[model samples]
Target chain A: MSFLAVEELVARIPDGAFVALPPDYSGCAMAAVRGLLWRPARGLRLLGVPQLGLQADLLIGAGCVAEIETAALSLGEHGLAPAFGRAWEEGAIAVRESTCPAIHAGLQAAEKGVPFMPLRGVLGSDLLGLRPDWKVIDNPFAEKDPILLVPAIRPDVALFHAPLADRAGNVWIGVRRELLTMAHAARRCLVTVEAVTEEDLLADDRTAAGTIPALYVEAVAEAPGGGWPVGLQGAYPADDAWLARYAREARTEAGFTAMLAEFVAR
Target chain B: MTREEVLLLIAEVARLLEGCRHVAVGALSPIPAAGALLARELADGAMRVSILGSRRHSPFTDGGRELFDCAAQGRIDAFFLSGVQIDGAGNVNLLGLRREGRPIRRFAGNFGAPYLAFLVPRLILFRTDHDPRSLVERVDFVTAPGSGPPGVWRRGGPVALLTPCCRFAFRDGRFLLESLHPGHDLEEIRARTGFAFALAGEPAVTPPPPEDWRARILGPVREALAEVYPAFAAGLGG
Candidate 1:
């Protein structure tokens, strides 16, 4: 296992790659997002695990994301995500809008190495009307009940921030199992952690349950405050003041550019 | 609107949530969260309230996945949802106005509304903004259908819709005007609402919350809401 710098880790991801991101409550790699912005990676397709918050907004504002497949993009209590909305209205990004659980089901199908996953609900909604790719079919097991089947979401890379990782590359995600599914489903899993622990995380039964075994991890990097602005679960609290400031400042293109200059460029 | 008026709506929501065991509040829903907390308090902690982002209120340890799992298992009794546009047919449009290929105006994508609308036993739709644009004749996009066809196996669908102007109880795949807010009348509701809804006899004025119950929500419930929605809690005084 190799430990790399945030820049180096982000540099490994090619332009136009299908990148999966962790949800808001799960650890989001803001430092890596900054690195991607600095590199100015273009045409990346973002896969939002159920939802996206500041990370997706920033990426869209930076002009990195060419397409986004997600459930929703909104800054939780801070209100609507500005960049995503602007991009969508301008037809700057291709959006494959999906429901939350359906995204989870798609990822789970990829994790289980299945071609598609059957999901309940969404059969009669306009969500089905838009996505011609999704099909409603009779449940083979049940007599005539119809269910929606979504194609598996196999991302090229899964990126996230976490609290701790052992030197062996096992990440301690701690109850955020969606990260595990992302890692298992993606071709490569890259993570940035607050600390690189000297002790093996799996040695203790308590930590073992939360630890993602090193086998699934492709690369690990030590980057404290990696999820700054967005909180790392069980590690540090979200910088609410900064987030509020971001929500205020990221409303316009000039404001967003200035924010990128202040936060990402420096 | 006055904070008292908001509180009255919340009280009505609490009344709607009387027998529900587990009520879940989604993101961007401060009033529903407040209502669920108030309901839980009134029930003497019998009702389980889970606000999506709250560390204190949410019981699930596994993030959002567990919430969906619990809803699928028929564990969640009630849930709250809203939309950019809501039609008389009870369809909600979270997606913005779709032209041919892309939407002219873009809102947030449908998160879990389609799934949870089917799974949860009682679904309450709320919108603080009650205007011709918001309450439409037909939604441009149906994020979640209010009612599904027969043999759909839905355990739940929309039960009621609450707006700042009035309350609507959904039945027979359409919303029926249940009651009007204290200051609002039938004519004003008709003028403001873009959709056609059946009036259930003569509309009665929505009852105000008990005087003592107001103290409970303004004090403890407001304090509790600070954990998940600091902005909304801070705005309560104004």
Candidate 2:
């Protein structure tokens, strides 16, 4: 379960594993995953919980996600606007009712295996029906009450990039704790750490301590610049020049492949 | 009744495009662009048209600098956006879910919804799908505040919610169905949505397209869209 290197960690994944990932390109997990696979294996559904930035773009660029379905509104700096409707037309995208907040809440609800979670004030919306699979079953015991029944979520594997993680898998997300739930929701986790230190992650900083516990993480890979093609915070701003080129190229499969090559070359 | 009627209804929607001093039509949003062009023609070039993907500005002298920058301009009076999911409160979300067991997908959230909702006096919501889901009791997320801080949006918040079947508007806290596109009856419109929608009797007949409107508007957009989006352009000819 414990791995010292990203290459060793990546070798553990079998082809065609359905990978659940964090949004807002984390580190080099996506680039490493793409480097390992010849072509993205079939049954590759990339489940991204809203994080924003290069994380989402790298997942889409890797050719691993057969379709992209999200509840967030804009791609932010990712600039996936033009590709938005086209992804739908190509049967590669779908926008559901509950945006990021609801999806995140739903995932948390599922990770707990709870029958239903009442999101204090989100009861009255179209998101309730967007997913035909989930039901808002009314409780028989409670009068005039209905609960949003979200199915349990157990990601086949979760790969996250944190600002810091020890070789033992203790992780810290720094100020941005966006993907904290993803680590808990994922069945198995592969963490790409920025730094591996012997100091206790909890003792180092109280602010980032609650982000991820080493107990839940199955492996730790020391993969810096893992969020390539997509930049990492405190490291570099997303290469706008490169992203502009990608915006032009990601329009088609052939173009996306070429983009992948350019990304790897960099 | 006929393709001509459908085209006319689309034009009528364009005619209603009055408040916007500066308007943005997407790369392939021909109907709205046609409406803008028609408005320009009718108003003797008074209205300015800014195409979202074109060369930023027109070489033909006067034009908005960039369609992307339309809202920033002081001239923009109204803004139009397509609502993929709308709640009774008028919130919308266009992002999809990214994980399974995850109730919904992850998306970038509204790029311009917040700005347009705040900047423009009137925010017009449109939907080609008049289905039950599109017009819902509530939206999952509020990317753009339709009525910010209660009375703030009363000045000119969500002016109207447009659908292929019917048109709805917000007036004094009530969501009213203003008109029905030609050939769509109250029953059909009511049947299409899951929410309780009010019907107006003898709603204004959606206008018909002027003779060469479709050719004038759709053709240029089709060509430009082909250039702007080649992969999508490849499939349109068939």
lDDT of each: 0.87, 0.55
For model 1, the stretches where C-alpha displacement exceeds 4 angstroms are: B99-102, B234-238
- How is the predicted docking of candidate 2 categorized under the CAPRI scheme? incorrect
Task: Give the alpha carbon lDDT tens digit for every residue of A1-266 in model 1.
Answer: 57899988999899999999987778999899999998899999999998888899988998999999989888876778888888877878898889899888898899899999987788778888778999888999989899889999999999999899998999998878889888888999999999998999999999999888989898998999888888876778888787788888889888888887877954
Worst 10 residues of 1 chain A by lDDT: A257-266
Q: What is the lDDT of residue A93 in candidate 1?
A: 88
Question: Which candidate number would show the highest DockQ if scored against the true structure?
Answer: 1
lDDT of 1 by residue, B1-238 (tens): 6887888888988988999999999987888998898898899978899898777878886645789989988999999889999998889888777667556787777999988889988999999988999899988888888888677868888999998888999999998999888989999999999999997689888999897778888788889999888877877772
- Lowest summed lDDT over 10 consecutive residues: which window, candidate 2 chain B? B59-68
- Model 1 TM-score? 0.96
DockQ, per model, reads 0.68, 0.05
The clash number for model 1 is 0
Predict model 2's lDDT versus the native.
0.55
Candidate by candidate, in order, the iRMS in Å equals: 1.4, 12.9
Error of 1 at B188 (Å): 1.0
TM-score of 2: 0.53
